[model samples]
Target: MLLTVSGPPGSGKSTTAAALAEAFDLEHVSGGDIFRELAAERDMTPVEFNELAEEDDQIDRDLDRRLRDVAVERDDVLLESRLAGWLAGDHADLRIWLDAPLDVRCERITDREEKPLDQVIEETRRRESSEAKRYREYYNIHIDNLSIYDLVYNTARWSPEGMLGMLTTAIDSYDPDTDEGKIPVEGVDYDF
Candidate 1:
C-alpha cells in the first residue's frame, strides 16, 4: 500500500507520517528531511536553501523527482511531501492532506523550532510564498488545490494523537473491493 501524507510545514505531516509508517509497517520517506539534509550539506539553513531553490529550479526538480520515483517504485511506503499526492499520481492507495489555519500552524512551528513566534511567522510566510510560486511556475501545480487528496484534515481541531488515530482508521478501513480508486489530478504538469 503506497500512501501519501501531504501538507504545509507545521501541519504535523512528518509526525503523522512517521506514526502511520510505524503502525502500518511501511518504509517512510520525507521530502522535508531530504531537503533539510541537502541544505545542511551545503552549510545552509532551510530558508536559505529555499531561496536558492527559487533561483535554481534543479534543486526542487531533483528532490521532487526522487520522491516521485519512490512513490512509483515502492509499494509499502509512506511518502510525505508538499506535492506527494500529485507526484504519487495513480500509484498511491491513500493520499492524505493535513492543514491548519496560519496562526495555529505558526504556533506549532514556533514550539517545534524553539524560535520566537514573530520570527517563525515571518520565515514561514516567506517560505510558503516562495514555494507556492515555484510550484506554480515549474509544474503548473497550485499548492492550494486540495481536490486530489483522499483525506483533508484541519489539524487545529484535533490533538496529534486524535489525528493519528483518525488516519490509522482510514488506512485500516480501506476496502479495495468498494474502492473507487484515485482521483486523477487533472492538468498537473508533473515535470519535475
Candidate 2:
C-alpha cells in the first residue's frame, strides 16, 4: 500500500504518517525530514533553505524527484510531504490531505517548535506563500486546490487517534483489485 499524506505546516501530517506507517507496517518517508537534513548539512535553517530554493529551483525539483523515485521503487511505503500526493499521483493507493484552521495550525507549530505563536504564524505564512508560488510556477499546481486528493481530513476536529482509527478502517477494507476500498473523489469532501 503506497500512502501519501500531505498538508500545510503544523497539520500533524508527520505524526499521522508515522502512526499510519506503524499501523500498516510500512516504511515511512518524510519529505520534510529530507529537506531539513539537507538544510542542516548546509548549515542553514529551514526558512533560509526555503528562501534559497526560491532562487534555485533545482532544490525543490531535486527533492520532488527523489519523492517520485521512492514511489516508483517502493510498493509499501508511506510518504509525507507538502507535495507527496501530487508527486506520487496515480502510484499512490491512498492520498490524504490533512486540513486545519490557520490559527489552530499556528498554535500547533508554536507548541512543537517552542516558538512564539505570532512568530510561528508569520513564518508559516511566509513559507506557505513561497511554496505556493513556486509550486504553481514549476508544476502548474495550486496548493490550495484539494481536487487531487482521495481523502481530506480536518485535523482540528479529529484527534490523532481518531484519525488513525478512521485510516485503519479504510485501509483494512480497501480492495485494490476491485477498487472497492477507494474513497469517492467526486465532491469536495472532508472526513472529520
Candidate 3:
C-alpha cells in the first residue's frame, strides 16, 4: 500500500511521514528532500530551483510518475511530498494532509533555517504563494483546499504521541481496498 503525506512548508509532514514509515516498516521517500538534494548538486537556491521546476513540467511529472510507479509495485511505501497524493493518481492507498497555523509554521521555518523569525516568515509566505500559483498554472493542481485528502491533521494541537496514536488507529481501521476511515492527527510534536 502507498501512504502519501503532504503539506505546506514546516507543517511537520516530514517528521510525521518518517515516523509513520519507521513504525509501519515501509519504504520512504521525501520529494522536498530530494529536490533540495538535487538543488545542492546544482548549487541553486530555493527560488532558482523553483524557477527551474516551474519551467520543466516534464521533469517534475516524470519524477513523480516514476516514484508513484515504485510505490504501486512495492509492498508498502510512504511518500512525503507537497503533491504526492495528486501525483500518485489512484495508486495511493491513503493520502494524509498535515497542517499548522501560519505563525507556527513561520516559527518552525525560522528555527529550521536559523534565520530571523520575521524574515523567515516573510520568505515562507512568499514561497507558499509562489508555489501555489505555479502548481495551479503548471499542473492545474489546487493544493490550498484540504478536501482532496483521505486524512487531515493539524499538528499545532496534537503531540507526536497523539499523532502516532491516531495514525496507528487509522492504519488499523483503514481498509486498503475501500477507503472508509478518518485519520485525525491533532497537535503532533517532533523532538527533532
Candidate 4:
C-alpha cells in the first residue's frame, strides 16, 4: 500500500504522515527532508534552494522515481511530498490532501519556525505561490485541486491522531484482505 500525503506548508503533512506510518507500520519518506538535505549539501538559503530546485528538474524526477520504486516493492509505504500523489501515479493506493485556512496555516508556520507572524505570513504566501505556479508549469497538474485525492481532510478541525485514524480506517476498510474487503485505492477511478 502506497500512501501519498500532500498539503500546503505547515499543514501538518509531515506530522500526519509520520503518525500514520508509525501506527500502520509503513515506511515513511519525506520529500521536504530530502530537499532540506539537498539544500544543506549545497549551502544554500531558502530562496537559493528554491531557485536550485527550479533549475534542476532531475531532483524532482529522482524523488518521483524513488517513490515509484518503493511502491513497486514495498507492501506499505507512506510518502510525504508536495507532489507525492501526482508523482506516484497508479502506484498510490491511498492519497490524502490536507487543507486549512490561509491564516491558520500562517499561524502554524509562525509557531513552528518562531518567526515574526507577518514575516511568516509573507513567506508562506510567496512559497505557496511559487510552488503552485511551478507545479503547474512543470507537471501540468494543479495541486490545489481537491478532487484529485482519495480523502480530503481539514486539518484545522482535526487532531493529527483523528486524521490518521480516519485515513487508516478508510484504507483498511478498502483492503481486499478483510471480510468487508474492497479493492485497493489504485482500483478506484477518479473523474480526472
Number of the top-ranking candidate, with TM-score as the measure:
1
lDDT string for model 2 (10-40, tens) is: 8989989999999999999999999999999
TM-score of candidate 4 on Cα atoms, chains taken together:
0.83
lDDT of 4 by residue, 88-181 (tens): 6656777788888988988998888898999888877777776776666666767776665778888999887788788778877766444332
TM-score winner, 2 or 4: 2
Writing each residue's lDDT as its tens digit, candidate 3 over 42-113 gives 898665676677776654666566666666677688988987777665667788889999999889878888
Model 1 alpha-carbon drift over 4 Å, by segment: 178-181
What's the lDDT of the predicted structure labeled candidate 1? 0.92
What TM-score does candidate 1 reach? 0.96
lDDT of 2 at 29: 95
Per-model lDDT: 0.92, 0.87, 0.77, 0.75
Error of 2 at 62 (Å): 0.8
State the lDDT of candidate 1 residue by residue for 66-139, as single tens digits.
99999988889999999999899888888999999989999999998899999988999999999999999998
Counting only residues 3 or more apart in sequence or on different chains, how many pairs clash (N, Cα, C under 3 Å) in candidate 4?
1
Residue 59 in candidate 1, Cα distance off native in Å = 0.1
TM-score of 2: 0.91
User: Candidates ranked by lDDT, best first?
Assistant: 1, 2, 3, 4
